[model samples]
Target: MTDKSKKVTENSDFIITLNSLTRFVLGAVGGYNMQTKLKGVREMNDGSIFNSSHTLEIEKDLLLFFNTWVDIQGDKFSNDRKGFQLVTTLIQALGLVFHHIWHCCSNMSKTERTHQIYIAAKKLAQINYSRDAEHWKNCSFLTLNEDDLNYKVNSGGSTTRKHFARYLCSKIGFNY
Candidate 1:
C-alpha cells in the first residue's frame, strides 16, 4: 500500500483502539444501564430513549467523558496540533449533545435539574488547561453577560444595566 494508505489504516486502527478503551473504561465505571439502553435502541423499533429523564445516568457519563476528553486533547496539543483539533472537535460535539440533553431535561423534576447542573459544574472544573479553559470561560462569560443584561432590562433598571455592562466590558478587555 502507498504511504498515505498506510497512514489511513493506522489512524483507523488507532480510533478503534481508542473506542475499545473508552468502552472498557465506561463498563468498569458501571455503565451497564447505558449499554443496555443503547442495545435496546439497536434491537427494538421503539426502544429509543431520547428524553433526558430516562437517560440521566447515561448523560452524566457522557458529560464526564467529554470533559475528560477535552483535557486529554489539550495535553495532546503539545505533541500534535492536528490531532488536538480532531479531539477538540470531538469535545465540542459532546457539548452539543449535552445541550440537547439539557433541552430534553428542561421539564424534568427540580432534583434532576440540580443533579445535572452539579455534574456540569464538576465536568467544567476539569477544563483547567489553557486552550480548553479559555474557550469554556469565554462562553460562560458571554452567557452571564447576556443573562445579566436581560435581567436588568426586565427589571426596569437601565442605569444599573449600563453600569453592569460597562463593568463586564472592561473586565473582558473590551475597548470603548
Candidate 2:
C-alpha cells in the first residue's frame, strides 16, 4: 500500500481497537455505549469477582501497558502522541482509550488516581500530550457520533479490535 493509504489503514485500526477496548472496560461488547459511558457500573463482566485487590491490579497493569505501548508505538506509528495518532486528524486519540477506560476524560478531573495516569504517562513517555489531553478533557472525547460504534470498530468484525479485546480479556484472566 502507498504510504498515505498505509497510514489511513493503521490509524483506522488504532481507533477501532481503542474504542473496542474502551467499551469492554465499560462492560460493552456488542456495540459502543454513550449513555452509560462510565456513568453507570454493573456487576463484573469479566467472569472474575470484583474486589479491591483485583481492581487495583487491573489498573496497574492497564497503566503499565498504556505507557509501554506508547513508548514502543511511537516508533511504529509516528511521532506525536507516542505513535497513538498515526495520521494527522482533528481527533486527539492517543491516550483517549486510557481515559475512556478510567472514566477520566472529563475536563474536570475525575479523581486523584485517574488524573495521575495522565501525569504518569507524561513522566514515562517524556512527551507533552497536553494539547490532546485538553481536547479530550471531557467525559467523552468522541462526540461526532462516529468514533464509538460505527465504522466497523466495536462489533467483533475486525482483527485489530479483536486483538485488543483479547488483551483486555487476558488482563482479567478471562478465557475468551
Best by TM-score: 2
Off by over 4 Å in 1: 1-49, 75-79, 84-176
Clashes of 2: 3
Worst 10 residues of 1 by lDDT: 149-158
The residue-level lDDT of candidate 2 at 17 comes to 40
> In order, how many clashes per candidate?
0, 3
TM-scores of all candidate predictions against the true structure: 0.22, 0.29
Tens digits of per-residue lDDT for model 1 on 1-176? 12222121223433223433332232322222332232333222245533435445455555554455445545542343323123322222233334343445569885786466445534443433333323434332222235332211122122322332233223333321
lDDT on C-alpha atoms for all candidate structures: 0.35, 0.36
Checking candidate 1 for backbone clashes, the offending pairs are none
Compose the digit string of candidate 2's lDDT tens values, residues 1-176: 13223233433433324433444343322122221243345335455433355446346635564556466446533434332233222112222334334443335444654555545444434432233332232313122234442121222223343333343333333333
